[model samples]
Target: MSAPPAPLSELPLASRQDGSHPRPQLIRSTWADLDGTWSFRHDDADTGLAAGWCAGLPAAQEIIVPFPPESVASGIAEPGFHRVVWYARTVSADDVATAGRSEHAPVVLLHFGAVDYRARVWIDGRFVGEHEGGHTPFTFDVTALVADGADHVLVVRAEDDPHDLTQPRGKQDWHEDAHAIWYRRTTGIWQTVWLEAVPATSIAHLRWLPAGPAAVDLSVRLRGRPAAGARLRVALRFDERDEDLGTIDVDVPATATSVDVTVPIARQRNGQAEDELTWSPERPRLVDATVSLLDADGGVTDAVSSYLGVRTVGVARGAFLLNGRPYDVRSVLNQGFWPDSHLAAPSRGALRREVELIKDLGFTACRIHQKIEDPRFLYWSDRLGLLLWGETPGAYEFSATAVQRLTREWMDAVDRDASHPSLVTWVPFNESWGIQHVADDPAQQAYSRALTDLTRALDPTRPVVSNDGWEQQNSDIITVHDYEGDGAVLARTYADEAARDRLLSGMGPAGRRILVDGAEDRGQPVMLTEFGGIAFQPGTRRADGWGYTAATDAEDWIARITALYDAVRASTFLAGSCYTQLTDTMQETNGLLTAGREPKAPIEQIRKAVRGRP
Candidate 1:
């Protein structure tokens, strides 16, 4: 197979030796990034484990960490599929010591941003842990395994079978070549891998739920068991200032692993009016906070910095509400694929740039299509105030294994991203890829309902879309996809009261029912989640690049897109619309920007089109 194309553009933060911490919400002062080059080899026979390769692999070539082997940025641009791959790196004593080593001994945690399909880790020839999901952060505590003042070898085995329909592969092309909507396959590590040092009794996870304009609910989960007299202290402050909003102290029972505490926010603090601190796209407001575990003697055992946005999302009266007001969601579909990096962004700046560019184009939200995006992307969205729909990458065929794999991965993704305030919805399925018989088969329908229920159970604060585009089962919102190129037809189909009623009552676009049997709309908010895939390739059409309707020229492309937006706006039923993408990917040229993120039309014009303004 030919190697993927090299990156057309480089961000300032893109480097082989990136040392930045991966997770921004939960910040630890002492951590080391292990994102540089690492010893790597493909284990085709899967005999590396028997050969004692975990201790050290002989004749292993160097490959860049974080970037997948399929991508050009990984240095080893071997695009062929290998079910298993091995990666090894050495961590020095100093690397662990820099993380606030104490006489009591610190807990060293090895974190992987993501590893495709499944991953197993070993430190100093001792097995640590394994993770199944490919799009969520997983960690292994190796404090007991690695001795201080010594060099330790870290070995990882990542196994993936993209062609296996049982696995949740998302947009990773299962075939040998990219076809239809699927692109190049991403195998092994595709995100940041790093190490963090923390106190033995540190805060493991946090969930920030904005109660209202006046209060925020904070949930804390502890990593290790604390002492009998240990207490959790939380202090909240505005990100823009050092003034304290409020503070809460919660006593934890020795057996308690988690605590939920509500902290009140004063409208006026220190003679300053702070009532306008609500988070929104116009003015993104973040409240910085610190969680500390204090012992009986008032000695701080552990502290971590985190930020939260005070915003609530709800759907009511056929409208999506943000902060209890009707908020129109102007969004674009982001597939989260780069021409060079595949599923991985070249840098954190690249992720920020993507969000910034989308926001600059007058979009209020991004529907991260199929792929569960990097946490850094969600971080930028939370910091910059862009609404997000956290979507699950779909599996093609339904099976017991597919259900298990998707359930495990979907829950992991929801848990990992539910803390972000910008995440407005959890989409577990898209267009019925895995459960193709969802509309007719009772088993598929039950599975769909189960996924929706699971998502709600995991994150009740956000809406759950069981199947985003069509073949809807039980969903909080009624969403559909239609690529009717004509604006008048779209308006007639979705805008006209009589036509819309018929569509909602029976079949929607593509002769699929808008609601499943025994399911009622119940005034749920409606969104045109996917539409307007106007393709514009400036020059020659590459073999793998195409779109729904090819634009004759730039002006024609702009006119078509603007018209589609106009139709969407004219539709009184649509609470929101997601334009068919942010950027082009292999075999898909229907993006406003090319695969390299070059604008096809004027930014202002695109903004006008997106915002439904002439």
Candidate 2:
């Protein structure tokens, strides 16, 4: 809004895009995005015990919000920023007050879109809360600690060891191991930073499930007691002028832990039942719903708004399907890395630009391979209409114990992002990273199957890729990757007998495959999910082993991808195909966009090869 608040590299670590012809804003709902100047400093240690931790810690260095400390977007691209760092900023107490207040609201929330690994926040030198996961968003209420209207200081201490023994660090290499795949790390606050004012009895999280036709079941959990004899009523509104769907009384006892409130979906103006709006590549429709918490006497207690779409995704007929239709997903493998910002997105505009570029290139979906994308990306996909296949970051080791914890964290990620309409599939393990004794290891295969089953249990609306290019397991869509084979070898290898076994057994790395002829159908189709990474040389000189080059220049790259896409399309046995990438990420120059999001390969070449050429 306000001139995008200078470049993230020039400001502090606080901070927090483009295509689709006339695409809608990707966010499910709009809110103030906090990405401007904030006070920042490097923490001296992990204890957060530095003197003058409150009342602002010295200089007013303007740190960019949302870009992570180590990123160029943070205005401080100092290496090893992930080792340990401290940040401090200040917000007003008046900021938390409502237009009309009794002067007694107990808590104020300081929200961080995401903080890598671990974080401890102090308000006025009083510890408020600590968070462990780095890739997911978290919030803390600092009301009790800060003095009202006294200009309180907020201190944040964050630590991220990319090579840590326990945490999950996807594709992040601390050192300069910028070869194939691995990229750099993003530490500290890398997402939105803001504060929300809520009543002491306000609602916390919402869980709304759309069950049956044109109806959604609802449950709201709140903090503090409801006003005496007050009854909570929930309403669903679809439009500004539409009549609110009649509110339903929420039954909650004083001792109750949660309130059960069911609000009916709205009916159309023409008297027909409101049709369920589901989101998919072909037709993306989102329904906006606002939930208002009412007191027993019909007084409005608090209201928080959110949006949802009624879509079903699953693996069927050997391929991922949406809304019961056979959806052939043409995807680009997205690494979620940036040259300036590293793992964190440089800016919201940058995220939108990347998604728009992917769609413009005729790709219908993206494999958010390994790293979990920022919520804003999912927000855009849900709003702007892009399909997403999400995967867990590969860990360094695996076992029954390790896999169990990994499974839980993976499920947590799914729950965190369950409401977005763009997410179509969940991938647990990729290329056997961290997997030990996978081949011929029944235990490993079983571990994979268990995780897949776990995903189904968590959210059955989407399909599960139990293992992608790892030893076979019970999965919905059968997926594989290919890179080692040349043009002729790749073309013929799919039909090879040995290759068929490998495909069936879900074995083989790039360039080689073994297909199975008689494997029982899991009701899912087959896909060469990762292939066609034909690296043609860019015109500029690239360091040896730094870029992809099956031949040279954009033309060669286009030819190879075109051939691969044609072969895949011609094969009736293939369900879909995803190119190696959407953009050239970091050292992997095979992407359509150079690392800087500049210099795209010839669009005509991609259209000729990928779009209707076959």
Candidate 3:
């Protein structure tokens, strides 16, 4: 295996040996981070299982948990493709017990932030669980095998096939060398790992649906069957204040695993009418919540802390509405990659920095292209008040396996992120990647429609776009991508009623029709989802880097960018626009910022051009 290259820059957050807690929602004080170093081995011949490596690997190299072997942060730094990889770590019984696990809370859950493609986990030589998705969190209960005052070996085996189009690889490069837009591949665990101790009958998942400014429907899914007379107690409070807004208790049936509780915000409190607070880009308000499962004796069996924002998103009259008002979405396409970390952020601070940078650049929204971003980033987006278009990574080929993988992973992504108020829309496919023949193929069209319908069924509060960009199937928004550099040409192309009618009625740019046959415009909101891939290399362009349009100098870059913005802003029919990218990636130098996150153009100029304000 080739050694991994040295990282160009190391963020301070990367120095922490124990990775931070991965889950921000439903947080518990009783948990231990299982990050640091672990025993590692490469299974080239896939003989690890036969060799009984899960029991204990002999003479194995040490690797940093959560960091993939392909990353420099991983001590092994093995860049070559290893079809099978084995990792082993030992956790002390004291550490597990310290998490407040007892006869009442006897369950010890092992959580993996994410493992690439396929993962099989073993606790003390017994197979506990297996997960197939690469981008969502999974957990296994190991209380039955683990004993107090003893150490237990935890082993994991991960397998990833880059060339397998059946798997959703996202932007991870398939070939040996990074080419075009695809970059380095992530093989093993690339996120945080931790152990959480909880009561056997604890809350497993939380879903908060804010129906109105003063109403929210909260659903709690329990880990175990409810006992007789058991009830879920919920209390709501403002994060900034100590006063409790309200409290409610819902009786959970013994046969039910989940129960919904309706919470209505009080209009008056403390002898005063409560101020109407809604979450928006300018002012974000989050309501802190304390959820507890109380036994018949009024004893708390389990408890967790969570938060939610009161907001609503909808589409009406060809415009996106936020809190019942037409909101203009000025966005930039963000791939959410780091120079050192491929998919994982260097640290929590790095994720915060990315959100701050986007807000400072005057963009209200970020279209996270081709990847389900880390939950921490979504947390930051919710806290920092930035709109997000949650997008799924593209699958290149079409097949039954492709449909299964994309549908399964995409649904998981949506379910995982459905609670965040920052997420405004769900995009299942981009530019007809896996469903390329949707314009002609009935099966493909039906598949696209199925995904759209499924997304809506899962999250009806948010809009669903079956396929973003050209040749739209049934979608809530009519979006297109055009990189016409000349301002006059762009202005003329999407000019007035006649021009729009001609373009929408017939062929669009590059002789591609905007709407597929049998699909009529349903007066859905229109937005240019992609445009202005202006590459502005400070000095000379690198031989490997390329963009749709190149600028000779800073002055030329500013003029071209301003012209494109002018055209987008002048179009009365369009509701929003998203620039090609936020930062440059490997071989794609069309970002306003470099790959290292340094600004390539003047911030003020770019902001004015994008937001049409100084």
Candidate 4:
């Protein structure tokens, strides 16, 4: 079936229109990215030439607004220049004009959907703001730096040295070479760039939290002078029903970061009064919240609205649980890679299609494997009611500085995506990657523990997998990746077969026992985390292009993967399982769909195999 065209706002800013498709609701509304041609430079200039970088900039390159430079969709396939690049664009207050607005709006904001590594933004050639971390969005109020209603020149400098540094580069490598598991380095203006007009003395941002049982804790921060009697009024709403939960008032001082307020269930209504709306794959409920800053006189100054779903996810007694119930995570390991778009998908519809495909196959959840997914993907998962296990990208080595940087990236990623109901798990490190000398590495263990603690502290609603596939260092879930693909062995251990068989036939172990003696454990709740990588080549295709495997046809791919699935179904102990991947990547042919977004095996075969039915 042909895919539906993506929504306008989800497209590159250049393609979005004022009145095109049906207006999609934007949770955290920000007006940015509607402007003139952006200037591009593949390399950064020295301080001597930095001043003239935006002035007399190069001609229009016709690159798409939001796609990354390395992506084919971005119209720039310069893979060689992946480390340092600069982008400059200009926007006027009129560029972001509202329906009925006067010329008095004070602060004009500049926003970046995301930028890799470190980035410094300059407005009208004056330094405005700098941000670290690439995966999460950041914004700067550049109003005072530019003229009131005139065109403002914006310049951005982004530098990414992936593998060589302590920064959280994920699967990105400094070398221009793409090797096993690592793809091309995507650098510079990967996400969207936009602008917004707001009052100079307004609410900067809101940090909304779900504090259990119809209670939401909000911390609102305002720009300009907070010490001079600035305050904020917060309100919660159930979007599906359009019902308001009243509002709360809080005072803020100038030197303070943000003002806090608690919205209670007794006084306010959150979505449907279904007794604490806990979200799950079967029942996903999201609470719409609007936060507004009011002047001391109680007049609205600035407002921003977002959504949050109340749910509790954790690992208890060797099984993953949701809302205090044992919930087996039947999932697929999603790589989030496309043949054409590399890290980013061609369109939001493409992302939605992936989620739909998973749902059609009768799986309840998915483990978004390594790389962080685009926000729209999570949005669909929440709306379509699919559980998600979010994980930090695995790296080759783990250093103290690297762990610190990873922690920051993790915090930003989870913070930005915490509102989505689909997400239920946060995995800090993946199977021995970046981990060396696990036996005596106190620092490594401590770092892993710290990240787990930090993640819990940030959003205590979800479970945290401290280390997936390795040492059982106090992780919430004892996750094990068994690639053996033997049904009898799994069933025996999982079914509590016998001690003799567990030692002799290599079977029969049960209930959270660690078998560190083997290469990887095969026990209760045994998840086939990295199995069924049977590659099948579609005729005339270059199966050798990608390196994971090279089986020569659809029949072979189905045969091997189906056999593995059959074995897994026979195991009584296996509570959950995840196929190696959902789709084929650049060099990984084990995907159900080819890197070109073509289905390799028959759809019927995939549906039956994944659902564990004949």
> Count of backbone clashes for each model?
0, 42, 0, 13
Candidate 2 segments exceeding 4 Å error: 1-35, 38-62, 94-106, 208-213, 217-219, 225-234, 237-249, 259-276, 399-408, 440-447, 484-488, 495-502, 510-523, 541-549
Model 4: CA > 4 A from native = 1-30, 34-37, 44-51, 54-62, 96-105, 162-165, 224-234, 239-256, 266-276, 394-397, 485-528, 540-552, 570-575
Q: What are the per-residue Cα lDDT tens digits for candidate 2 across 1-614?
A: 11111121232110012221111211111122345666677654543364655435665456787677667778876656346777776555554442122333345666676787788887777777888776766777666665355666777777776656446677877564554677767777877776654566766665555453455656566767766655665554434244455556665677665776545554532234343345566556666554545555555556555556666666654556666567788888888888888777776677777877777778888899888787778767766678888898766766554565466568768867766778878898887666655555666666766777888887766777767764546667777777743656666657444555556654466432222223354545777888865554466545543433455656666767767776766665677777777666666667776777654566666766777652
Candidate-wise lDDT, in order: 0.82, 0.63, 0.81, 0.62
On TM-score, the candidate that comes out on top is 1
Give a tens-digit lDDT track for model 4, residues 195-308.
Answer: 656555555655555566557666565566643565666555555556665666677666766677776745324445544455677876666655555555655555555556
Q: Give the best candidate by lDDT.
A: 1
User: What is candidate 2's local distance difference test score?
Assistant: 0.63
Better of 3 and 4 by lDDT: 3
Which segments of candidate 3 are over 4 A away from where they belong? 1-20, 241-243, 268-275, 541-543
Shift in Å, residue 292, candidate 2: 1.2
lDDT tens digits by residue: candidate 3, 243-349: 57888888888988998888888753222433345788888677777787877766677777777888889999888989878899999999887766777776778
Tens digit of per-residue lDDT, candidate 1, span 433-484: 8988888999999999999998888778888887888888688988988889
